[model samples]
Target: MRSFLYVPGNQPKMLASALTRGADALIADLEDAVPPGEKETARHTVATWLRSLPAGAPVWVRVNSGPDGLADARA
Candidate 1:
């Protein structure tokens, strides 16, 4: 089992840096790192980034949980 490091989905620079770190998996975090106004943007950005990774490299998305703002964030 390999560990995944949490990287802010909204920060393109950080995401790029993390992808190159040789981690077994990367966790593109849309929950804590992004502010309410940037949730949608972060989701899209993370989706795009995940698509670009190599076949063997795993990318996981950490979405917001629960109802209210958390649910909205996941949406």
Candidate 2:
């Protein structure tokens, strides 16, 4: 069975640490876990981390529910 571990996207430390965990996938949370002011930073951080992760480990960003979420996640 696959499992996804959630980590706050704005936190570099958590992002770095999550990469080392053996979960089947990771959810870099840009939503509820992050404060409103940190949303943009989280998006950038998650995007960078997504690029650096190994080929086999799937990584996803959980965007906020607001109208800008999709745009922010893609940014």
Candidate 3:
């Protein structure tokens, strides 16, 4: 986990390729990298991405902190 990479959650191609991007950890960004209006779509994409990750993958989510973030956490 010495190195980390941040990928915008809305990019399908980047998301698909994130697993082997060589970073020690991956952050599927749902905050600033994504536009406000696209948060819902990003959340769905990030949820799918998290579920698809292989066992032992080093990943961390950076959801905004608040009710909106709580909603993302719930997703």
TM-score of each: 0.75, 0.83, 0.91
| Candidate 3 clashes between residue pairs 3 or more apart in a chain or in different chains | none
Best by TM-score: 3
TM-score order, best first, reads: 3, 2, 1
| Prediction RMSDs, each to the true structure | 2.9, 1.6, 1.1
Q: What TM-score, to 2 decimals, does candidate 1 have?
A: 0.75
Candidate 2 Cα deviation (angstroms), residue 10: 1.0
Over 1-75, each residue of candidate 1 has an lDDT whose tens digit, in order, gives 476788988998898889678778888888888898888788778777777778977777787876534654544
| Model 1, residue pairs in steric clash | none
Q: Candidate 2, residues 1-75: lDDT per residue as tens digits?
A: 378899988898999989678888888888889998888888888888888888877777787776758767567
Give Cα-based local distance difference scores for all models: 0.77, 0.82, 0.86
User: What is the lDDT, from 0 to 100, of the residue 8 in candidate 3?
Assistant: 93
Lowest summed lDDT over 10 consecutive residues: which window, candidate 2? 65-74
Error of 3 at 18 (Å): 1.0
lDDT of 3 by residue, 1-75 (tens): 588999998886898898888998888888788898898999999999888889988888888778879878888
